[model samples]
Target: MKANVVVIQALEAQIAELDARLLQQAKLRPEYLLLKTMPGVGEVLATIIMLETGDIDRFAEVGNFASYARCVKSAHYSNGKKKGEGNAKNGNAYLIWAFIEAANFARRFSDDAKRFFEKKKAKTNSVVATKALAHKLARASYHILKEKQPFDAKRCFA
Candidate 1:
């Protein structure tokens, strides 16, 4: 038990050192801070989103960003009958992870977010509700990055 405790402490110390080094090395763009204005996003999530997104102008539209983030569902329809979905294994997995993490944090930390999630959860399942929230956050983040504007919870949540 003593040896295990020593090992765990050493690992934790290493992790903290690496985290500080990453913070020092990263060149945080203005958009990184703007990304944090959203309900859920913190330093880590904002950094991930900003770095992974690269240039926001590359995405022509909000839907394009959402699609790239894999927050939007792929659908296949034939004669108005739901057939199947396209390849689900497309888009940036990292962005999806970040957005989903943001959504969960938003739900836990903000009353507005919790209310919105609850409303959606009442109509749908928890997983679906969370995805919906993530989708919203992804689109909002795209606009925030593109416009170089901070997040507006009213515009985003409402």
Candidate 2:
């Protein structure tokens, strides 16, 4: 029991040390501060987003960025008939994870986000609603990164 407790404490200390180092590196990037302005995105998530989305200019449009983040639906259709599916797993998995995580937190903290999530939930299942919210966040983050501006809930949720 004592050895287990000691091991847990050592691991906790190592985690804290690594977190501090990550924060130090994140602070050096201006995009980190911009990303942190959004609801539900904290130090770690902002760092992940900033690192994963390197050079936002590479994306031609917000849709492109959202697609790259795996936040959009991947479906292939010809005319009015459903044919097949696109490569849904082609984008950054880490980004989808981060955005979905952020969406969950945002629904709890941001009123606009909560309202949007509930509305979407009413129309679809919880998982779809959550993914919809994540998609919104991904698109908003794309604008934030490209424009180097803070997040605006009014603009995002409107």
- Highest-TM-score candidate: 1
lDDT per residue as tens, model 2, 1-158: 99999999999999999999987766457878899999989888899998999999999999999999999878888897889898878989999999999999999999999999999999998999999999999999999999989999999999
State TM-scores per candidate: 0.90, 0.89
Residue 137 miss distance in model 1 (angstroms): 0.7
lDDT of 1 by residue, 34-106 (tens): 9999989988889899989999889999999999999988998899999999878799999999999999999
Runs of candidate 2 with Cα error greater than 4 angstroms are: 1-12, 25-27
Cα lDDT for residue 152, candidate 2: 95
> Candidate 1, clashing residue pairs?
none
